[model samples]
Target chain A: MNFSSFPKESVKVEEVIDCIPVGVAVLDTNLRLQAMNRALEAMTGFSREEAIGIDCSHIIRNNLCTQKCPAKQVLENDRAVHLEGNIVNRERQKIPVMIHASVLKDDEGKPLGVIETIEDISLLRELDKKTRITHDFADLVGHSPKMQKLLEILPIISQTDSSVLITGETGTGKDLIASVIHRVSPRAQGPFVKINCGALPETLLESELFGHTRGAFTGAVRDKPGRFQLADGGTLYLTEIGDLPLTLQVKLLTFLDDKEIIPLGGTRSARADVRLIAATHRDLQAMVRQGNFREDLLFRLNVVRLEVPPLRERQGDIRLLMEYFLNKFNRQFQKKIKGFSPEAIEILRQYPYPGNVRELANMVEYATNVCHESIIKQEHLPDYLGGPWDEALRPEVRATVGEMGSYPGLEESIGKRVADNRLNWREMERRMISEALVKSRGNRTKAAKILGWGRSTLWRKMKQHNLV
Target chain B: MSEKLLITIWRDQVAPRFDLTSEVLVATVDSTGEPLHSKTVVLPTVSAEDLCHMILTEGINTVICGGIEEEYFEYLSWKKVKVIDSVIGPYLQALELARVGKLEPGAILREEASQG
Candidate 1:
């Protein structure tokens, strides 16, 4: 920015500089303290009278003053020098400061003097440290509002040992969330044992979870540790828990209530200190009505429920994921795929990702392997996603593509439709949802798909807006 | 008992900063306000904590240096040690001032070394 633009006819530059909260110091050609502001005096614990003739380094007392005097460097190089370092004040406290130094010259370009600005950044550093601690969510990438909000709170929630129940559609990265929870949890060093309830028969699943004695089963070779025992002092992630047999759900509920698990054919029960993190794409509440899942287990696990929004619901995030997966696949395939063509991006944006991120990753990987060109064009993409946009993409998905540019007259149309100029954002959103429902003939599933929201979220919002 | 004083040094001048100072001149002064014996000690590295520990362990009566952090100053004061901080210019002039019991904090003595 231009600081010299201050009207010089009425105000003196020194008057302006002196009033600034940031400490500003002007050094003569000798790099001595020629002039300093009030803030500088208060910062260094030395009055301007005591500091006037001293060398700049001795007055500022920045730790890097002697080794790499920023002012002198700016003078020699005739360019700006910026650095962060500790400065000891008159009170003898080490304060973190950002120093900016540059040379001041006359119209003829004669090197006149150096001007340096020192800003206390202790608060900034402290805040940055907090943000670093709270958002240590590495490797998870999403810039959409819903995903950003979820990512922001993930680290804080992971600090607790509460049993987390993650619900989302298939291919929505539910397993990744479970892993992140275990990775960042307090019991991160302990073994993270994962079991798919649907992957095994009910008889074998019980033994696999609550280890059996050697003679308990015909095929049992020796005494074995159950998943719960094996996962002691750590986390146990049960995926597809909806598919778990009703009997096993009761056993899981017993373990939840009292951290004791009885192995098959074993009379004694062993206490397992395992933090539970279960995930499923299925609606367990509906399954409870069908007499499949245990209501008590559902209540226990639902203490902390995280709903991972489907890819279509996370607006403006598809591009971010596309670039992320493209760059990722580029390295794995040893090909320099710059990016997708605008036509491909338009098509990808219009189509609703039914399988979400996992499906997108597959498409990118397939294109990376097949494409001979640097850019991924329309033909490089999977053949399934390449057909006519209207027929291939759902009308509900195309209606709520979410980008403002897609509906060029959106703001104007909203303004024209609403008679009151004071109508707020929430009102506009309600109006849009109402119109989408009307257009979808009051079919909630289609309306929800049109609104780019999960059915549960849409239902919740509908109740909030009194449209239920 | 003779009083001992420590002066943080950067070359011949008092160091511009105490935390970054590596060399110091320690003087055992007699009652006449002159050094009975003096030696310069070079630290392996610059550390305010180490210097403060040395000040306490070595039984130094006074500390004379350039800009020092308040925590160290308060710590040494809490320990009953005199700290003459923020003194610039030659260590010889600063030491002589401290010997005469006239050296003050924020004293920027030049090469001419005027008593005033």
Candidate 2:
């Protein structure tokens, strides 16, 4: 196996090395690049001529190069070494590579040099990322048992054209589930139209849902197709279904029974081939008992019901969702903020998100925007959560100003308030700002910074409080 | 009229991939295709989005690189920046041809001796 004893022209070693798909480099006993194949040259962005005689560490700038040189170890031990590491290529992109280094030996068992092979794993890494994203149903990422059960039934539900009623708390991804159902349904190719029943007044909402003809109202100068007609051959999602007026509920019931709709001021009824999906955050059964909602209409829309679990019920999803959103926002903002500090993560895990998944997403986005460091800290959280409150209770549900004096502890005072009671959240917020200002000696800028708020917000708060 | 040209570089050569290039050479040329000023910028990380941002913020009218992804190519094109990609050659030779407005997309300037 001595280089001097081997035939000089038996094989073109450089050509054979260049022919290999993976990158290959032959280093001298001193760990200098004796020769590099074309693949190695391409991977490192250094030509063979430029790479020759250069220090192997300088050419392959990897994390292990400064600490443990595999080539140096292979030369020392006269054995092969394999390592999984990453290299920052000439393009400045860090690529994961598998390095296999073996000592080249002479006939007398003397080490000549080290031959290293590098296999780029960029494609494998990309596939792994894709697999991670696809593990969830569509884009709704959750792996908790509750979420898993919901995901298991989604495909089956999407197979049908029946009307579906989705119930969840506000910001619990009801609208997202509706869209996911539409996307996975047979009518996926057709348009998916959505309208919020509570967003408009009764008359406007009626016209928006059901179409209008000329002279139907003073503002109606032309014919218009409503959501049902627009969603023909597709799916129609009605958000905030609890807000649909009792009178309009009859029209919806008729459409569900006969699949026909009569435009305002039009004599003839038209057929609409649209699947219906309704979502509501309210207790429709309670509304039914209170005579606020028609039971028959509820029955029609509730043919198939999907209940989305709140974030508190599925606490395991918090970290998963946090990481998902962290990666998402990192790509969006072009920032490389890696993860949250232990304290920040603990605070997030402990705090119950009343606003559900949407709130968590907003929290991540806010932290990403304000966090200049690589890791998000508790200080980067929203100002309300900066306090020592166990849960993020809505300000309106917390104890009133008068009751605040009764409880000695701040958390107990905040936690003592009852639900369904009316308290002006803005007034409470204003009072808190006033107290902070007084504590800071009326320095608005200092108070604003201490409150994790901008100077303009403090000024506006002061104006609203008549403390200007 | 003066125009700015950006070339993605790797070890004194045109990098084989645009998205992977960490360093770039930006040259300002006058109406006669003579370089007025030139400078090199090293990025902290490799990213097509960051490269697009640099192309826009630095007012680069033309870009020379290799193997650009379709998204970045279309984005740069939409931004009205002329992109000459898939170039294979030494950095100095690419600059010389670019200064004379003779560097074309997919141009190979490597010497015959180096072709294996």
Candidate 3:
């Protein structure tokens, strides 16, 4: 007859003898190893002949499961127990492991010691570490498919130390991208130094990029380390590369070309083992054509071009970024704000964000400070954002019946004729407002300044014109 | 229906003291005497066709402006709008003059001029 008809105890023995991933052991009250499977032999580097009838401690190398171990805790307490930590393999290398034990008894309900199983968890722990590192940059918020694509491409790009050129409108996260590149690169342990080419004059920019000796200039009181020197063996981000004055462009090109820098007022040239990353909002090719920029310099910087699309093109990202900044500012300012009201978010979505991510960040920070309730209301947003809230209150169809008939009684025929001759005031107003909004990025105060109106006057006009 | 013409006056040329050097005023008026519409654009310069397109978009058929560049005037005349030359006034005044029929087509002769 087939042994498949065998009783439960025999099956229990057979099942324990065949379980694959786990190393199972059966022991009596004396803690002697009774039975083990092929998996146990593979896990412990022992055959059945060597393992059977041996003390369980011989294989686990502990004196209590080897002294009062997890198995003992379960046996003494008559409950289950679990323990996790590193375990040494046959080669004596530490492998992460987990163990669980439960008391095993005969039909008479007497405690027959415990049965324990061990599982190697080294690969799981490694996967966990990898996941945590991946999650580290998730806090850098952006959700446009373009941004998502950029993020997707970042790791592949980070694997190599090729020179990268990041291009976008002002306030786009070019510097943040540079940081991400550095963090993911092999040089992550080294320093990351950043220099703004537009912030300094040409003479000073030269000294800042390449360190100077004592008395390099009239005011040089001592030797100073430039960004490249400070970022040796790491990454150096040169921002506004388009603005690097032509006189300094040659020096920068030479340094990037030769991987060396000649310090001001110094005869010796120093090797800089720095990875070059540059960012600019300006059109370098147009500048090259205009003869204001160096063509060689452009070629050197555009090795791996990363173009960050404008905010308007990526409207879906706005809400994600807004919520991220809201949470960030809530924690920073110790506020209890929940998030933007639907109306406020709608208004924000309609805005054509010329200032890009930086402007959105500033708005969130500003609103968080002034919000009283958990939910950020429209009024809490700066006037530029809330200004459009008033606009939303107006009828969605912009052309009103009143505006349609307001023309002086020239018959619809004569009115159309007169309207044709009349200054296209409405279109003109719309164009002016659009240009002003673009220049100011929805900031009514700045837009008002551009339009030659006081703050209060601008508010009144926004209300009057239904332009909020 | 009679056709209409469009005109655009350079903001700097219209208002000498304002910082609106980058703006252009667009107006749409019919050939005889009816007000159509007007708008402002922030552009470096305006050409005759730029003015004509602005008016055509609003269905206007007549054009008027102050200090027409010779090239633009010739192009505008060729495009069938009465090109008003040597006229100088405030933007609204020019429109009102166009409205009341005070401004008339003085000279429409063609002359060689720089396209720019």
* lDDT (C-alpha, whole model) for all candidates: 0.82, 0.80, 0.66
Worst 10 residues of 1 chain A by lDDT: A1-10
Which candidate would rank higher by lDDT, 1 or 2? 1
Q: What is the lDDT of residue A364 in candidate 3?
A: 83
lDDT of 1 by residue, A32-126 (tens): 77678888888888887777766777789898888898988997898999999979887887889999999977667876678899999999977
lDDT of 3 at A197: 93
The DockQ assigned to candidate 1 is: 0.30
lDDT of 2 by residue, B1-116 (tens): 99999999877667756766789999999999888999999986576777999999999999998667667888899999999876766777887888888999767564621321
Q: What is the Å distance of residue B69 in model 1 from its true position?
A: 31
State the TM-score for model 3: 0.46
True-vs-predicted CA distance for residue A112, candidate 2, Å: 75
Candidate 1, residues B1-116, lDDT tens digits: the string is 69999999986788878889999999999888877999999986577888999999999999999988888888999999999998987899889999999999978895432211
Candidate 3: misplaced stretches above 4 Å?
A1-132, A219-222, A388-468, B1-116
Off by over 4 Å in 2: A1-136, A390-468, B1-116
Error of 1 at A466 (Å): 61
Stretches off by above 4 angstroms in model 1 are A1-136, A389-468, B1-116
Worst 10 residues of 3 chain A by lDDT: A392-401
C-alpha positional error of residue A351 in candidate 2 after TM-score superposition, expressed in Å: 0.7
